[model samples]
Target: MLILGGTGDATVLAVRASEIPGVDVITALAGRTRQPTVLSENTRIGGFGGVAGLTNYLREQQIDLLIDATHPFAAQISFNAAAAAATTGILHLMLIRPAWNPTTGDRWIDVESNQAAATVLPGLAQRIFLTIGRQELAPFAHLQAPSLDTRNKSLLASQAIDLWFLIRMIDPPPPDVAIPPGKILLARGPFSLEEERSLLQQYEIGAIVSKNSGGDATYAKIRAARELMIPVVMIQRPSVPSGEQVETLETAVAWIRKQLAIRA
Candidate 1:
């Protein structure tokens, strides 16, 4: 089995799935982070080009099953995995975690893309906490703060008040990457609620921009935002490939076992 993995759920799934007696789990990471947590000795890093490359890999590896447990926002890879699995005549499963929903006290403004999030940000707040991943920061880089002119007609210009981004990611982005004006915090989660609250309070964060990459690992920020009453400019997840997808780790493992049993 080839597991398209990068998210924490993928790691957990790899470990659980490998325990199935006859299953051989090979987890693949995209190598986005400087130092990704090693899943196992069978883990492979880097991309497989695209659909063609991945299809070729599936054929060469003799993989009977392909499981995509990548980040929710990894639309391209998910689509590629689906296409490759179909081309190779292999069973494919998407172990995508469910997206987060707004609850009581949550102030979430849903947007289709990061660019849409950027468009709505100025009206929301000045000091922004950007929980979106490092790779997705380009849209917010040129965000200009609202300015008050003599006539009070807000003008959009780079010279206007600055729009600050508190960019947080597991690893620092490459030197060449263009990020918004802000401080970069390199850390991994599940961050504790206390820590999340402190970080938001410390920065006096007025708004948070986050991808709806659902899971408990980073949900503390959302919870903290709710408590603090800070609005979150939530970027809705991209369209995933149409196929069989299970939301829980248990269900995925069960499906793998069932498939193996049927084959046996």
Candidate 2:
């Protein structure tokens, strides 16, 4: 079985799948992070080029089942996996955690994309906590104070905002990319509510910007925002290729076992 992995659920699924008798599991990581959590003994890192490359890899590996246990926002890989499975005549399943729905006291301003979130920031609070991943930081860079140049004064003046961001990520962003003026917190998630609340209070965060990548590992900040009555600018997940999907890990494991049993 070939499992496309990165998220916490993916890691757990990889470990569980490895224990099943006669099942040889190989997990693939996109290698976006500087240091990713080790999933299994048989793991491949980096991209497979594109759809063509992925289809070739699937054929060469003799993979029986393709389980897309990737991040919800990883639409490209999910789409490629579906296409590749169809081309190679293999079974494909998507194991995704359900998205977080708003409850009472939760203020969520949903947007289609990161660019839209950035565009709407000025109208919200000035002090923002940007929990969106490092790769998506470019859009919010415009919120930074304008550069001092006479020739570009008009453009700069138009783009200028009083907003200050607190960008948090597991790794530092790429060197060449420009970012908004704020402190960067480098840490991994599965954070406690106390820690999340303290961090928000310390930074005096007025609003939060995050992707709707649902799971418990990084959900403390969302709860903290709710408790603090802070509005969240949520960037919605991108559309992926349609397929059989399971919301829980157990269901995914059962589905895999059923497939393997049929083949056996």
Candidate 3:
């Protein structure tokens, strides 16, 4: 059995799966997170190359079942896995966490991409707390670079740099942003309100950027920003690729049990 791992729910499900006798489980992580949770059984870190590579691996490993338990934002890998499963004829199940709904007093600015958020940034405010993923950081390169008009005036105007981004992510982003050293903050979250408040205060943050990755792990920052009356540059969850999705562990367990019984 193969399970895509990293999500909190996925880890919980993996632990439960490890309990089943005679069922070998292999969980794959995206290798994005620094302090990832330990799986219930054998674990593998890093990418699968692509669909072709995964297809070949599936045949060689003779994997019987595939469980996609990756984060909601892990779209490309999820798509690749789906393609590999279809070709290899491996039984596949998706265990996706549900998305979050907006609550009262939440000032949300829904954006489609990192660039979109950047476009609105100048109007929103100068100081920003960016929390989009590591891989997604490259798109913000232009923001990191100074404008042509500003560069001609003086080095001090460049030095002043009204627009600032306080970026936070799990893994190291590709070296492309070229942002000033003082601007970046490499940290993981499940951030406490106190921590969030302190960070925002220290940075003098007027806005926050986050993806609506539904979970409790990184939501305290949003609440902290809210208390500080800072706006959140929110990106909604992307639609799931074509698949049968299971939300809760109960359903996933039942589904897996049925599959195992059928195999038996």
Give the number of the best model, judged by lDDT: 1
lDDT of each: 0.90, 0.90, 0.79
The C-alpha TM-scores of every prediction are 0.94, 0.93, 0.85
Please give, for residues 1-264, the per-residue lDDT of candidate 1 as tens digits: 999998888988899988878888898999998888878779999999999999999988899999999999899999999998888889999998999999999999999998899999877888999988788788888777766665767665645786898899888887777899989998888999999999999999999999999999999999999999999999999999899999999999999989988998
Task: Tell me the lDDT of model 2 at 57.
Answer: 94
What tens-digit string does per-residue lDDT give for candidate 3 at 183-246? 6667765788899889999989888888888778888888887787888888877666787888
Sort every candidate by TM-score, greatest first. Answer: 1, 2, 3
lDDT of 2 by residue, 1-264 (tens): 999999999999999999999999999999999899879999999999998999999989999999999999999999999999999988999998999888999999999998999888876777899988788788877674443457844536555655799999999999987788888989898899999999999989989998999989888999999999999999899997888999999999999999988988
Overall local distance difference test of candidate 2 = 0.90
Clashes of each: 0, 0, 0
Q: What range of 10 consecutive residues in model 2 has the weakest lDDT sum?
A: 144-153
